[model samples]
Target: MVRRFGNGTATARAREEALGKLPSPRGRLPVIGHLHLLGSFPHVSLRDLAAQHGRDGLMLLRLGAVPTLVVSSPAAAQAVLRTHDHVFASRPHSPVTDILFYGSTDVAFCPYGHHWRQVKKIATTHLLTARKVRSYRHAREHEVRLVVAKLRRDAVGGDAVNMSDLLNAFANDVICHAVSGKSFRKQGHNKLFRELVEANSSLIGGFNLEDHFPALVKLDIIKRMVCAKARRVHKMWDDLLDSLIDHHASKPASERGGEDCDFIDVLLSVQQEYNLTKDHIKAQLTIMFEAGTDTSFIVLEYAMVRLMQSPHLMAKLQAEVRNTVPKEKDTVTEDDLTGLAYLKAVIKETLRLHMPAPLLVPHLSMAGCDVNGYTIPSETRVIVNSWALARDPSGWESAEEFVPERFLEGGSAAAVDYRGNDFLYLPFGAGRRICPGINFAIVTVEIMLANLMYHFDWKLPPRSGAGRWH
Candidate 1:
């Protein structure tokens, strides 16, 4: 029998043979190739370089010891994230994430393999399923009610609410209850959760000298700082997760029964089925709380900022939300969200403009592949510049503007969806590695937003003079 490519392997090989070397910036340095060119904002910097070096919107750069491919256009993104998705599904390894996220044992950063697949299977099927998320509706509604009460108090006091802080707290409360079965803030202790989030943010906010400069990898000062911080964060995070797990583990399996068990309880129940240990349970919980809470607040903050900037748009969404839910109803339920098309559009527009993770977490190629006629070597770090792709002029009209109307009926952007099918608008990303928590995230956001809009009228600080949202 003649051997043949089963699923596009032959086609990819042919394309790679036809196309030669990948496009890269010239004058790369000896050790820190192309690292000097990237400023603080790497997404914007890469976008600029792509304009000059990306022949087909794919540009290769050497960041110290790592060879990275930046995909700055929608077509290029499709080739990497969809056309050859399986080949590039694994995540890149970083010392920072390894320490902070338990050696990338968590679902978000774990490499693509048996372990990752198993964890993902358990999480998607049992932990984060739509039914599982729906079971937590009471927790969500209760948290949102608390948020509204706080905001109403501020409103009565005639004070300008710090919307970002308020939303962050709201997200934190919801995630805490859903994950560990209680709110740390409400307990007035164990604020370690919030501290961990801040530490992780600081460590991963941007590229550090150690990341790009292999020569500095052994520097004692850098190692000490990184290790010390990691140890501190790990200790606190571990203790908290351990206590939660132990608290649940102490209970008899029968007593911990039912669909309403918190995430910790559920993970413990299936520990033997999935062959999961306490460490594995902790890693997953850490990610769930960190990723869930942070992204929710970021998206909410941006949406509110955009709405405040455009009063007319705010009023329009608010009216839709208000009309959908009766005046007598205390809060909007998940059922009411289905009919609020405009509100959905507003959230979609917000994600397009301000994606929480602009690069959609860096992906590593498991094998060599061809993308848009460019040969990408195995283990190459791939970054899909979702920020640039979302604002590409070719795919979107007035892409820079905040226009929710584009997603309305009969508009050019109306047919496009953000569930990753349309590469031109992947806020959550595409392929097998797409964010599995999308449904959970969407429901959490929609319900909270529906209540926020239905209840109060928001305005900018008096005489602030339309300052920058950031």
Candidate 2:
């Protein structure tokens, strides 16, 4: 057999790859760029943009001062996030991140490089390892029981329990325990954390005006408005984190104070090893608490919402959770999750339909790269719409429906996973910068959902009670 390298096909392919311009929407404003196209729900708006303009799966839009690339399909997501991950490994800088995350020193916003890699390594290996996460089994179980107990107490008088607030509190308390070895609720700091989480979500959710129009923010009016909000948030974050760190620091070396010697203790012990300063520790703790509590609870809340929407699916999950745990068992253990395959499938389905960060954290291109024969230049803010990708018709059957069975053993979409392997199903994202909290998040969400389903039967509020169930 002879292999010829002199064919015109090779040269033609190279030429095509080299000369391609990124597909962009038609109406791009001069200074504001595509900022006008983005509305309150940018994910939906951008998804529409990709559908109309991104015939090749990648759409280039100028977002204010930044050139942004939106990856709306699985194949394109894989190309950008997996194939040429290193080029798109870094995170794009935004005023929102800088102000909220203490100059983006935290893991999520930290620029991709040596410092990021070091912090990531420390977190994955020491803080969030499978063994470390599993070690907190008691803490998770304890919190879940508290959730069940509270629901029971509410049910005693036939009273409606607000799962939203209670679940938020449950997640907050669990994360507080894991982070600092004590419950923030008991300490009366849960309200502050709650406010911070709400603020972070609001600021992070939509397109911030200051982020898009950086130059416009230089005006006294815009600057003061933005700075005022940022300062208030920063002060709250600073005071709470300072108190948490101080509490841990005041502990005697041998005492090692904390519930199960929390993440705070772990980070403090290795502070010298990582050359970490107080700000660094605070940033890390802030991220851990903020991300762990807010995102996990949101997922749980949505899971419950979805379950209540369909009684059939709810019954299926309840049966799995109930059968997996013995009738006499008061709490569902982590080991029991292995046999409860359908419960896991329900969680997957929920995430597929309602992703936490619909548009994942944007990636920055460290250098120019070619995606699907199009050249994405350096410093382009790359966004993978995990929400759109999850619901893409080609990849998922009954794309808009809530079908948990699709992720079950014999189902067609069973092979897809959330652990960054299958690009089409990346609820957590992919590549070198994939979320490091996978183990922690999965465990927290699964346990919480399992207990909620197992212990109590949920009911829709009477006012909105219609034919929601199937």
lDDT of 1 by residue, 100-185 (tens): 67888888889999989988987899889989999989888988898888888888878788987788877877788878775355
How does candidate 2 fare on TM-score?
0.91
Distance from true location, Cα of 245 in model 2, Å? 0.9
Q: Write the per-residue lDDT of candidate 2 for residues 1-470, one digit (tens) a residue.
A: 11112237775454334324677888878888788898767788888889999967888888886677889988899998888998889997767777777878888989998878878987898889888898888988988888888888889998777888988988887887888775465788867787787777777764577766678677988877876776688788989888888887898977663436788788888889998888887778888877888778888988888888788889988988887799999988888888889988988888898878888898988766667877666666888999888888988899988899998989988888888999888888899888888888888999989988888888677775533221
Single out the weakest 10-residue window by summed lDDT for candidate 1: 1-10
Give lDDT per model, in order: 0.82, 0.81
Supply candidate 2's per-residue lDDT for 212: 66
The segments of candidate 1 whose C-alpha lies over 4 angstroms from its true place after superposition are: 1-20, 183-186, 214-222, 463-470
